[model samples]
Target: MDVLRYVAFATDASGGNPAGVVLDASGADEAAMLAVAAEVGYSETAFAVPRPDGGLDVRYFSPLAEVSFCGHATIATAVAHAREHGPGARDFHTRAGLVRVGTSVGADGVITAELVSVPPRSVPPAPDDLPELLAALRWSADELDPALPPRIAYAGAWHPVIAASTRQRLAALDYDMAALGDLMRRRDWTTVDLVWRESETVFHARNPFPPGGVVEDPATGAAAGAFGGYLRELGLVALPAELTIHQGDDMGRPSVLTVGIPADPAEGISVRGAAVPIPD
Candidate 1:
């Protein structure tokens, strides 16, 4: 029942996104997890109970509700596990499905973790839902990139992909938090992937996670993975592409996520980032 807070995707303490983690949460129930997450007050908190099979039963919670999965929290948990039990592979039975996380520590004592998510999938955004999304974001139909039309993509969770016309458009993220939170709750979305294309393999993004009781997320690995699927599904980018997604600059945490998409649709996409501990 120990709580550890770690920030993923950045080496600096003040840089990456912070997530709360509980390594041995066998005694905590759903209500307990929710209360702990709310008290932690980060974007997300991870709870893991060691299983008899040597894996883990993992759950994620935001300040508002429980989530199916969370990448940053997973990364933090892996590093924390490695710190206590040494670096290795860890399996998580998440609400979304099975998640495999691996960790390694450098000679300099820096820890890095990578998570392989469940089978990813993507579909075009519902015609009816697009208008609601645009309204919530205060974006016009004409402002969309057109090349990257709206879609809902999933790795471990669902995120609506919305591409902005320019980097400037993506950076300015003033919106109605309460209204957007209501919309996300209605759709059961984890986050809105607001993006700008810097190149075929490079992008800049901002994730609005109002329903999580946060105005925005500094680093969003779930959205980044789903976005890789979105680009591949829409034929906006070629196969086996290594894409770079830069996020959190506007919020000052400045995180970077690297994703790889395979040629086959059935394969689970790979998302990689560096994680360092948030000092006690």
Candidate 2:
């Protein structure tokens, strides 16, 4: 299994989250995928096995365990696929659901990809669970933004959305990793979506993903998809609004995620970004 190491979100390799992409993993099984992910030591690794039906069966494995969906790996794998086969549309059957990706190269020679996420849904977190989550993150109720209430949102995976009133509160992240990981695993949450509103359609986010054995994700499309749902549910943005997500600035990776939310409630939101290879 040849692992293609690539960093997603940032044009330069050194500035984004690095992911392990196995372009061909026909011979590898679940055990092999787990082992390779651990060996690669990245937050997540993607294994793509081509199917006879012309689609691919994609699986995501973090250094610790398998996950339902991974945004960075999907972006990295799609870009890697486009680099070898020429930019175009592609499909993959992931653990979460069927995902479709469209790819193209710009005049500046940067490979860009936009993925239509599965239908998103949002629900309030269990009131009983919120206190535990708050404890793990050392967050008080007053620190939360009143406009964006806490909710558990899902597109491909579930995330508890927590909005801080200020960027300073979001930037000073010091959470109990083990405690939060335990809470997340028991509740089947993907990450803690800590965010700050910069404007009506622009926001800054930071995801604490201890369950994935990573401190944070530089660019998270799945979370962005769910975030759009959160905004729509709360009527935070106008109908048919386009949103921008700025993440990883605190980590120095500096990722930008674009979200296109349609007026229809059932339609999938679009997440667009560009990725490049990380030279080893």
Candidate 3:
């Protein structure tokens, strides 16, 4: 199998999150896909199979297990496909739902992809889980931002959205891997979205993806979509807003994701970013 490596949400190869992309995995079974993903050993590997229809069937796998959806991997795959097949719109039929991606090349020959996620939803966190969640994160309730509150947000996948009261609090990330992993498995969470709002339109984020056997994800487009929905649902942001998310800087791999929220709350959120091929 030919596996392509690309970094999403970064202008340079040094930044953003790296993902494995398989342009054609039509003949590969579940086991084969899993094996290939493990061999690639990125946070997530995206497998695309061309369907009889024009759409593509996509699946995402981590080293340890398969996930319903992965944002960075999806971005990488779309950009890769565009580079090979000419930039345009594509529809991906994923386990989560039908995701539409639009790709374009800039004058500088940089490829950018925008994905519209499934309709997002948010549910309040169970009261009993708060202590366990906080304990696993080694964060006290006092450190949480009261305005943002706590909830499980879902766009293509579920993520516990936790906001820090200060940038300092968000930066100091130290958690028990086993404890957090177990908790996430029990809760069926893909990642924990830890965030600190810098302004009304700018935010910094870190994603703990222990369930995928990853300590942190540099840029998570799915979580960004869900976060845009969370803000709209809670009336935290004005309609038709554009929000900028800065991630992976703490890990020394800076990534930037732009989210567009429409006026209609039921509409899917759009997450846009640039992807670059990683040189072997």
Candidate 4:
């Protein structure tokens, strides 16, 4: 199988999150897919088999394990599909759910993709686990933003939403990887969505993905979708709002994600970004 590499959420290859896309993996088994993902060594890789109904059955695998859904990988795969065939909309049946993704070529020949996540949802953080969680991250309760309370948000995967009170607090991220990773694995959390709201419609984010065997994700699409749900559920933004998330800046691989929140709470959130090929 051919493994194509692309960086999602950024026009340049040096930015965004790199993902391995296997456009045709119909013959690959679970073990084979996992082995491929581990060899690629990205946060996640996508393996897709085209279905008879014109859709795709996609599976996501990190270096360590399989994840239900991955936003950046999805974006990269969709753009790769568009580049190979043509720009259009298609459904990706993932372990989490069926995600609809559309791709379009811009005037400058840049390919952009948008994925509509499954219906988003959120729940309050587990009171019994918050203390240990904070201890692992070395964050105190006072460092949290009062306006944006903590919540476990879900679009395709689970992510704990933690809002830092200041940009400095978010930037100073020196966490116990082993401690946080153990906590996250037990809690079944994909990543810790550490964020700082710069303005009403703009925010900065960092994602620690221990379960995926990655220290941090340069641009996490799934967490971005979940964060949109968190903001909508908390009434932090007006209905039918558009939000911009700046991520991977502190890591030096700057990436941008645009989120569109609809008025209907039951509707899925929309995440849009661009993907470019990464040279071997």
TM-score per prediction, in order, is: 0.97, 0.97, 0.99, 0.99
Question: Which ranges of candidate 2 are over 4 A from the true structure?
Answer: none
Candidate 1 regions exceeding 4 Å error are none
lDDT of 2 at 27: 81
Write down the RMSD of all candidates, one decimal each: 1.2, 1.0, 0.7, 0.6
* Tens digit per residue, CA lDDT, model 4, 1-280: 8999999999999999999999999999999999999999999999999999988999999999999999999999999999999999999999999999999999999999999999999998788778888999999999999999889999999999999999999999999999999999998999999999999999999999988899999999999999998888889999999999999999999999999999899999999999999987
Estimate, for each residue in 58-162, the C-alpha lDDT of model 2 and write its tens digit: 999999999998887888899999998888888878988988888889999989888877888999889789999999999999999998999999988999999
- Candidate 4 clashes: the total is 0
- Candidate 3 lands at a TM-score of 0.99
Pick by lDDT: which candidate is best? 4
lDDT of each: 0.87, 0.89, 0.95, 0.96
**What's the residue-level lDDT of 107 in candidate 2?**
94
lDDT of 3: 0.95
**Pairs of residues clashing in candidate 3:** none
Better candidate number, 1 or 4, judged by TM-score: 4
Q: Cα miss at 157, model 2 (Å)?
A: 0.6
Candidate 1 lDDT at 194 equals 92
The lowest-lDDT stretch of 10 consecutive residues in candidate 1 is 229-238
Query: Across residues 8-106, which tens digit of lDDT does each residue of candidate 1 receive?
Result: 888887987899999999888999999999999999999999999988999999998999989888888888888899998888899999888888888
